[model samples]
Target: MTSLLRILRFAPQLNPLYLGIAVSSVLAALLSLATPFLIGAATDRIVDAVAGRTGVAEAVTAVTWLAVAFLAVEVAATAVVSVGGYWGDVMAARMRTVLSTRYFEHLLHLPQRYFDTALTGRITNRLNRSITELTQFLQFFANNAFTMLITTAAVLVITGFYWWPLAVLLAVVFPVYMWLTAKTSTKWQVWEGEKNTEVDVASGRFAEVVSQMAVVRAYNRQEHELAGFRERFTKTVGLTRTQSRFWHGMDAWRRLAMNVVFGLMYLIVFVRTAQGLFSVGDMVILLQLMNMARQPIFSMSYLVDSAQRAVAGSKDYFAVLEEERERAGGRALEAGEVRAVPNGPAEARADVVEGETVPLPADVPAVRFTDVTFAYDDDAARPVLDRVTFEAGVGEKIAFVGESGGGKSTITNLLMGLYPVGDGRIEVFGNDVAGLDLAAVRGSIATVFQEPFLFSGTVRENIAYADPDATDERVRAAAKAAYADSFVEGFDHGYEQIIGERGLRLSGGQKQRIAVARAVLKDAPILVLDEATSALDTRSERLVQAALEELMVGRTSLIVAHRLSTIASVDRIVTLRAGRVEEIGTPAELSRSGGIYAQLLQLQQAGTKEAKRMLKEYGIHG
Candidate 1:
């Protein structure tokens, strides 16, 4: 009930519409009171006429009129109820849109850790359930609950008009009934909360298994997974059974209370009639009104249940919204800087400034890291990157060579502002990346990773991900440059081929090429190749390397070096050892220096020549 009241606190914004709903509800309630009076009067006349106390013709006439009046009252009540429902729906829809959209928008901006750590099914289940209950609870409160209150009050007042004692007796009993219900219902509220959490857990497990069915089958763990699911399912069933039995017990007591109240009201009516103070028709009306009170009386308890469900659902929904949003305190991206230009591509809008758009100067490095230090977690003893400083000026291709934990990829993550820096600065075009919109900072750089992830869409759509509005000519050109055009054209649908989820339908080499095409299509000033061509056959590597060379011609590129031979043509190579700069020089200079770079190069060229020999037999080069 507290949650119910708290949610209704949002009703002030819908005052005018809510006020209309209120008026309509009252009208319906007042009209409902007409039923008992009209029927009671008609019943009296029909009885008298049948007994010859009144002429048959006159009684028939009177009864016909009463029936007509009753019909009219019902019609009017129905019309008023319809109008109330309309306004209730409008308010409900508005609230749903505001709350869910805001919730989803919060999800969109939440820090990366939320997505990485949260369960997909749990998030979705909470989102969906919360929305459903919130809408139901709110809509019922706005119209149905209001109407019930009015009907209850109108019945009491009409009873008082005929007999004040009856109304007073009700006023006292109603509060006690409500109070008892609240106390008992408090316990069931915990049941609803427990059920919701268990559902989330079950949903999460089911979702994970469904998404990873292949792994489950390969590992032959179906029985193991089923045992876990059965455990959760049994717990849910036990909780549900206990909650239902308790409610059923409470229901028996509720019926006893209702019967007692009905009998008391009947006894008082009979006493008044015996005292010659009330007519039989008056007694009939009191009985009719008492019967009408049943729905609203039970409804009060039901609504309390609904309110509890709403409260529980709201907790889950707000938990998601309460997560920290990404820090976006930076200048907005300039028009034509990252996203596609409004009218056309960048080539078409070379000097066309549509509005107050700022362009980066031509001479500044595409990106620069100055004494940057970072850790994924703040309390960690060792940082991923410590005082890592480097610069990639315009069109200068630089590569970072390191062991697995040497923080090569972390540099790119820092530059992209995916994580907050523990200390120091990263700049894009001389402006602190922190002081520029993170989206814009990311937009200015096109990245291709080792494991390219392509969504389940057509080849054209995947390639045009960087610029959804790209023309067919642009898509084909980018694909051709990345050597993806040959295979794509071979497909039955050509550019429209439906690649399966994560591009699983395509070979690894094919997926990487499409990724390269996507980056090429963006034509951003900065390019990031994070082991982009690693794990490919020599034949595929050569093709991808050629495409990489084409894409790097004008943009400043940062290459996370995976192999020694590939990066020999780069402007400079920075060797990182255990998260610190160990050496920095040209490939030729490093090879001649007899240091870490020289040792790494010698070690790589020493791999048993058999694998390389077989690869060379198939016209492959590495």
Candidate 2:
């Protein structure tokens, strides 16, 4: 119920439409009440003619006009109802769009930990089901509730003509119906919430299996997966059945109670007529009024059911909407002129390379972290990164190497402002990252992850993703620099060849090259390579690495390397252990110091030797 109220607060623009619908509903109810009176009048005329108090021909003519007027009222009422329905649909669509858009924007601003703790399917279910339920609640349930109110009032007015007994009977019966409906609706809502949870779990499981189909097939876990899905499905079906049966039983009881009351009302009217308390036409009008009252009572019960469902669905939706977005408060990164550095072969002198470095303005460090700390949850069982303080000078190439959980990715996320700092601060280019515009912060850096992500598009489009407005010459130049042009040109479609989902149509090397091309096209001052060449073969790695060296010439580069050989030539390495920086020095200094870096180097050499030995054992070597 609280959730439903929150969602309804999004539509201040729909108030006028709701007002119009309400007015139409009241008018329709008045027309419905008049219908029985018209019928009663026609009946009274017949009774008069039988008594010889009036002529039959005049009554017949009056009946024809009354019939036409009734038909017109019915048609007009339906038109009003139709207009109300159409307006409701439009309002629902706009509200759904507003809520959905807010949800997406909020998600974009959420911290990395939020995503780690939340499932994609659960979020998707809440967004979809909430909007759908909210729309129906406004369109049908809300309108019905209002219509029922007006109809009840109209019925009371008409009942006054017959006798006060019928009105008293309705007064007693309506409360009982409402009480039963409320009780049944409460149980139904709980069951519906449970059913939605089961649905989310089942959907998440299906998504997981489909995403990892290769692994599932490899382990022959098809039957196991099927059994898991069936268990969730059975639970959902069972709950749905239980809820349906209870509501159906409640509906049957309500109908029985209503029929009993209706029968009693007719008996009273008939007895009164026999006793000369009322004429036949009056009894007829009493019966008609009783039937009219039943319409709202029956409809109200269904409205209660719909309202409960909407409340349950809105609870899930608002839960997501109410979640806090990533904090933003700091200074914006000042964009400076990018001086083009001279590109040359790998053998260029160190002094020349140092001279080519682009100078950052005095206000900005290439990167800065002050007393930073981060935890996935507030409980603080373990911190992902703790008191991590570091600063990188402009145009410096810094590499981070450590075990898998050493917080390398977490650091990158913080730098990109994807997560808020738990303690202290993070600044990029002199501006506190938290205070800067997220899109602007992200736009200032170009990243190439270990596994490149490519949407379904032509090679040219994929490369141009970094800068959508990049010219053809710029795209070709970046591709050529990344060594992607040679192979791309060989394809019949050349740059226009469409890649399949996630670039599955391309080999690992080809995809990496294209990703590299994209980053190069962006030409941001900061470049982050997270195991960028980890997926490529040695030959491809050599070619891509050469291209990367050119790209990294004067830019500030942060490299996360798995292979020791990849960062051997880098200026400095920061070794992390258990979410803390353990070592920071030149590659040679760390290699000779016999620390984690030395151990990694030894492992890499041993692995290389083992690979060679395996080739020799197979009698297939260069």
Quick one: best lDDT, which candidate? 1
Tens-digit lDDT track of model 2 for 117-173: 787767777778877877787778545667788878777766865688788888888
Summarize candidate 1's per-residue lDDT along 252-285 as a digit string, tens digits: 6876887798789889999998796877778789
TM-score of each: 0.87, 0.87
- Model 1 residue runs over 4 Å out of place are 1-23, 47-53, 86-97, 251-255, 330-358, 592-595, 608-622
- In candidate 1, where is summed lDDT lowest over 10 consecutive residues? 349-358
Model 2 TM-score is 0.87
Clashing pairs in 1: none
- Residue 482 Cα positional deviation in candidate 1, in Å, after optimal superposition: 2.1
Query: How many pairs of residues collide in each model?
Result: 0, 3
